[model samples]
Target: MKDKTIDYLLRATWIAVAKMYNEEASKKGSTMATGFALLNIDPEEGTPSTSLGPKMGMEATSLSRTLRSMEDKGLIVRKKNPEDGRSVLIQLTDFGKEMRIFSKQVVLKFDEAVHREINQEDLDTFSRVAQTIMDLINNKKIYKKQIPSK
Candidate 1:
């Protein structure tokens, strides 16, 4: 290819961002996945174990591993949901709350830096483009089955 494609650009940018986040998280002895999960969990009301996977766009197995690590770190506790007998709630401990704050600050700092560097109009266009890509993927419009002519 003579030039990079849209997907390539998006993938490269996201990879860089993920690496940056992981580096920052490592300084505090955490991973980006853990920080992301912490941010997704509700502080006041515990989140449902089943819902956490979907909410964080994580697979059940991966989410389970991360949750287990968090539990081992004494960052979170799993309590049986009083409202539902079959489900459990993932509640953060004081330590989890503290880490969540740190994660939030890291995300906010990145956002602030981007905003300072990019104008609002460019940011808006970038958001719209990203959303459009998401919509296409979510709607399954990008890849459809086609029958071959005999």
Candidate 2:
């Protein structure tokens, strides 16, 4: 098979795995961590909206939309940036903080289970392969560069 075909297979596999997790996660929107990396970010540091996109594997527009939705859900609040009136500052609400904690536990168990199945050498190999995949996605902004790119 061609390299592109292989790449497509890999992409399909990733989508399948993600969908499996998301299906499980749908029960508690954000509680099971369907999109944990995107959701659980650094605590409210008075950060700018534009800056968070690249740091969190997001684009400004998508992040804005997500933030707006989360805002409507009372999970976050956005204020006009004092330093730059043109931009918005984001901070999680009390509800979001609590949810972050709960989602983190789910993430931890997921990580532990995946890690437990692999030995050290294979773990290193897996990390390297995953990083390579991420590098490809990051440089290309593949599929919009949302969350870990892996």
Candidate 3:
């Protein structure tokens, strides 16, 4: 399409990337979100249940569902945090550690392929543009009311 909007491009690119990851995850009997969560968890120290949502950019409901699925699959275990009695810590099982390594390799492979395909200058510009967009949104400059009428 001609004159594609920035948001359209961003959304389309994300959807494409998500689809690719989903396909890969399916081969492992898992979802992309599950792989992502696995990657975020600290293999040795474990991660807090409350922090997983923010780390994964997931909603509480979605994170809870994913955590439950992982638990059922024997990929993760939950333990009460000794420091904070009210909080729970999430640790991966031995199987989960193996899966985490696989997930890491997949991510690294993607990065390698992208770097091979895209030149450094272009990648740098893309990174800068993406960061700017995130900053604008984070600062509330992208709010509907804040955007000037075109």
Candidate 4:
């Protein structure tokens, strides 16, 4: 059936992508997560865990732990917001910015590979489909990672 075919293709694509990611960064963890968070956050305004959760689809507590781990990694530093002491703003450390720059290469490679794999028509269709899926899932927020339970 068409539904089954679509499901199979989607699952296969996901597995392939995940496998590629694992191979590319076997030791991936806080660094990548921090990079993603840094990417979504405002470069100047910064952002807080409460504002970041909806984007990453993670719970606030989960985002907090992830930020703590990244802080321990020295990838980011959190400061209590001066305007609102109740909130904390996150900023990437110098090391994190360097790491993010390096990781951009990985993203570039992924983009090149994707472009090579799909034709123009397919790419357009994919863009639309992906957007539709995200719209269904994201609730107008950005992307984020879930903090693994300890």
**Backbone clash count for every predicted candidate, in the order shown:** 0, 0, 0, 2
What are the Cα lDDT values of the candidates?
0.96, 0.69, 0.93, 0.72
Lowest lDDT 10-residue stretch of candidate 4 = 25-34
lDDT of 2 by residue, 1-150 (tens): 465775787789778767766765665674222245335455666467777777676666777777777777777778898999998877777877776666666567767987899888998997899898879777885666458655
Model 1 Cα shift for residue 62 (angstroms): 0.7
| Per-residue lDDT over 6-49 for candidate 1, one digit per residue giving the tens place of the 0 to 100 score | 98998999999999999999998999999999999999999999
Off by over 4 Å in 1: 146-150
lDDT of 4 at 52: 85
Q: What's the CA error at residue 143 for candidate 2, in Å?
A: 16
Clashing pairs in 4: 55-142, 56-144
Write model 4 residue lDDT over 10-46, tens digit each, in one string.
8899888766655654455534455556566665567
Model 2 earns a TM-score of: 0.71
* Deviating ranges (above 4 Å) for candidate 3: 144-150
Best by lDDT: 1
Candidate 2 clashes between residue pairs 3 or more apart in a chain or in different chains = none
- TM-score for each model: 0.95, 0.71, 0.94, 0.71
**Sort by lDDT, top down from the best:** 1, 3, 4, 2
